[model samples]
Target: MIEIRNLKKSFGSNLVWEDVSFSIEQGETVAIIGRSGCGKSVLVKHLNALMYPDSGEVIIDGRNVFDLEYISLRKMRQRFGVLFQGSALFDSLNTFENIAFPLRYFTELNEEEISDKVMEALELVNLAGTSEKSPAELSGGMRRRVALARATILQPDFLIYDEPTSGLDPKTSEEINQLIISMAKNLNITSIVVTHDIHSVLKIATKVAFLEDQGLHWYGTVEELRDSDNEELMSFVSASEYQIRN
Candidate 1:
């Protein structure tokens, strides 16, 4: 499990968050939601020690994140799998190479072993035959799935997805949402998903946390969100202007 305690962060004079704390148990999918510029992105970065806070502590599976040495930090990061905002695929690499990138860097696996792993990840995302395609050749939804393939190819112990279904058709969004949940179970990994999509929340959130006012507004089960009386979360769930185009 990951536990964040009394976290605080700032940029010069602007304080982003203070006293932020929450926990994500193993095998649970925690969905975080907040308005734009509410520091949601900043908080997720702290999960893998990508960014450090000015004070407080993040403990991942019993190790203090900030205390880890350089090599330890690198090893710590290997346990994390991140899917970025827009898949962030390299334009020059084909899908197979993209998925194989981390394996080639982190392990001594030969070409055949790497190919086997890449193919498994691609199969999990149902993109088994698109290995030769470049980022420019795939649709936005497919690119996201390819990125997911790349992220999970490492088989991280914990996964963080930042807006996994940001831009896609309704059907594709549903497919992506369901796959996110299925992956957690199939991989037996802890998932921390940050998104504004209520549909995705309702569909896959085992636990939900409302982030606002520089701290955790509320943290509870998905049923609690649906039947919530919290005003902050109500506003997020009721937000109606985030238009999704076809």
Candidate 2:
């Protein structure tokens, strides 16, 4: 389980999270939803220790992630698989090379082993036939999947995604969410997603954390979101049709 207590962040004067607190259960999928700058992305960074909170704690599976030493922190970081909003694939690498990148960096596996792992990851993301293809040749959804494949190539225990369905059509967005959900269940990875997509919130979120008013507005299951009376969450959910806008 990941426990966050009284967490806070700021940019000199502008506070992001004020006394924020929440818990993410082991192997549970939690969605953090909010407006563009309401600290959703900041919160996910703290989970992987990419950014430190000004105060409070992030206890992941009983270990305080921020308090660990660099060497220990590196190991802790290995437990995380991350997908950024734009897929963020290296333009210089082909699909197979992109998937093999992490193994090359994080493991001492032989060439044959790396090859097999790359294939496994590609298959996991349903992009097996595109190994030799470049990022430029793939569609938006395919690029996103390649990034997902690389992120999970290590089979990390935790998955963190930022705006995974952003910029995709509604159908593609749902497909991406479905893939994310399938990956989570198949690997039993603890998944934390930061997105403004309500469709993602409704379809893939096992639990939801609404960040607004400089804090965690609400943290509970999808049922709680559906049944919530919180003004902020209600506003977000009801702002428009719950589908991908772009």
Candidate 3:
């Protein structure tokens, strides 16, 4: 389980969010949603200790991640797989090399082991046989898949997606959403997605965390979100096609 207790963060004199608290159960997919600059990305960064909160704690499994030593924190971070918003692929490297980057850096695995694991990850993302292709050679959706394969090459326990479907068309976005669902169900990995797309949220999230007003305004299941009467949440939803009944 991942527990975020009373977390707060700020930049200079500007407050991003504060006193946020939430817990993500193992094998659950949670979507963090809010308008732009509500600190959705910042909150996810805190999850992996990529950034630290000014106050409070993030307890992953049992240990507070913020309190871990550098070495221990490095090891802890290996448990996470992050798919960045822009795919963040190395244009110079082929897909295979991209996926193998982590294996080479983090493990003592030889060439044969790296090859096998890279292929396995490629297959997991339905991108097998594209290993020789560069990021420039693939479509936007395919590039995202390649990035996903690379992110999961180490077989991490948690998957964090930052705007996974941001630039894709509706059909492609749906495909990515399905892949997110598959990653959680097939791998039993905890999935945390930061997105502004309500359609993607409906397709992928088991739980929803709403960041607003310098705090977590709401945390509940997708079903509860559909039925919620909260003004802020409803106002946000209204901007999308999801209408809440009074």
lDDT of each: 0.88, 0.88, 0.91
Error of 2 at 92 (Å): 0.6
Overall local distance difference test of candidate 3: 0.91
Q: On residues 131-181, what C-alpha lDDT tens digit does candidate 2 reach at each position?
A: 999999999999999999999999999899999988888788888998989
State the lDDT at 83 in candidate 1.
Answer: 93
**lDDT winner:** 3
Per residue, candidate 3 scores C-alpha lDDT tens digits across 149-214 of 888888889999999998788888888899999989988899999987888888889999999899
Candidate 3 backbone collisions, by pair: none
Q: List the residue pairs that clash in candidate 2.
A: none
For residue 112, give model 2's deviation from the true position in Å. 0.4
Error of 3 at 164 (Å): 0.2
Give one clash count per candidate, in the order shown. Answer: 0, 0, 0
**Any idea how many clashes model 1 has?**
0
| Local distance difference test, candidate 1 | 0.88
